[model samples]
Target: MDNTFARCEDLVFSYDDESRDVLCDVSLSFKRGEFTAVLGHNGCGKSTFAKHLNAILLPCGGSVYVDGIDTKDEERLYDIRQRVGMVFQNPDNQIVATIVEEDVAFALENLGVPPEEIRERVDEALKSVGMYKYRMHSPHQLSGGQKQRVAIAGIIAMRPECIVLDEPTAMLDPIGRREVLKTVKRLNREYGITIILITHYMEEAAMCGRVIVMDKGKVLLDDVPKEVFSKVELLKSVGLDVPQVTELVYELNKYGLGLDQHIITEEECTEALIKLLS
Candidate 1:
């Protein structure tokens, strides 16, 4: 069988030694070049699961493999980390160097990449995220969105096969959110990078190829955005709200409007409503 990019097989995890498992026998697979969104409420183990992808957290039971390399193997730790780069929520916490280019160069430096190669990779990464012009700027002086892009550039410099973002935009405002999301989507669509995004934002989740909804540490739903959002009751039960447009369509259907069940975008909803009226 061809090796998957990432796989969690019967995985179980818990921070407390004696507490119940935070992730209970959870199993999932992510192929290379796929964009996957993981959604769930707080304490639902979504972040914990993200940590496992890069071997930041080891499974209490079962296993997590990145490109068929077992995460439990200490010898493969560095290899797994280089293969799956992570970006966390807080931009402040992620920035290591004062200068934008220096921050982007940090990870590559640690990996002992040659100085000449580091400069090339850092420049490419900054350009990839549209932050090359800010390479000399101090990270503290940049706007929230710009800073977040620098953080993403830092990860990109590592040249990971997959990037796992854990609530990467949660700390940003609307503009920042859009900027980060657009950058991430472009990376997935254009560069063929596997992206596993863990977020609560319905709109961001909608942009992914597949959505996995978790509740009480287990996956309750795993399907395409349209199919997952169609389950209004199930999503609500897990404390998740569908995209506003999807909810509007669901409510319209309830009142005998008979709109297309797959209407997810605002434009689609508007067109469906017009057809219903006509």
Candidate 2:
């Protein structure tokens, strides 16, 4: 049984006829419950490619499918969006209601879901993101991370099977970034929601199960994080970086230290160094 939750096939898109293609022959599939990170420099078409997952942007030359439904099927637009929700870079743009709980319930209310069910979902979503205590609090009063969590709660309340986050932590500080990332990872690990995270932060990508590197509107690399980060020189050539620890290991390997080139985490790098010294 194939487990593809979303897919793009030979996708080719451009802003207009005069402009260059933003995505060229981009074909990839997201598995049902995998945590995948997309990495690329600015203007590398990572964000544009993400929009294709949910029909936000249509392919001029190929197709995008979610749960086997083609995104171009206007009749299934609602179905596609419900299955694959989007969380953009700015949380402020997504939060609609003044109250945290109300913001979470906004989508359900719009869909005309029952009041009782709405209440249940609102509470559940907020609690999932660790923000139930602030349910009645004003969203404007919360910190950046809190607001982003609330925004995410809003999407989860709608019960999306997958989430496409386009640089969700870009505007956040380190603490805020950590808070959002933790919530995202938990949702994928605990609830089995497929995650497609488009980010430039090497550290953030390192935490994901799979990493895809994009350049010039095409996929340059796709593999497990350790495998993808192993190509430090190639990534650097395309204006991308591996995790800091991966880079350190790569540099040490250059000096014949015989460290692992695929070390992507601090713990692994530390262990490798300790073993070498011992």
User: TM-scores of all models?
Assistant: 0.97, 0.98
User: Which residue segments of model 1 deviate by more than 4 Å?
Assistant: 1-3
Task: Give lDDT tens digits, candidate 1, residues 1-278.
Answer: 77479998999998876587899999999999999999999999899999999998999999998998999999989999898999998999989898889999998888899999999999999999999999999999998888889988998898888999999989899999999999999999888899999998998998889999998889999999999998988899879999999999888889886777776788888888788778
Number of clashes in model 2? 0
What lDDT is reached at residue 115 by model 1?
100
Instruction: Give all candidates' CA lDDT scores.
Output: 0.91, 0.92
For candidate 2, write residues 42-118 as lDDT tens digits.
99999999999989889999999899999989999989988988999998998888888988988898899999999
Worst 10 residues of 1 by lDDT: 257-266
Alpha-carbon shift of residue 262 in model 1 (angstroms):
2.1
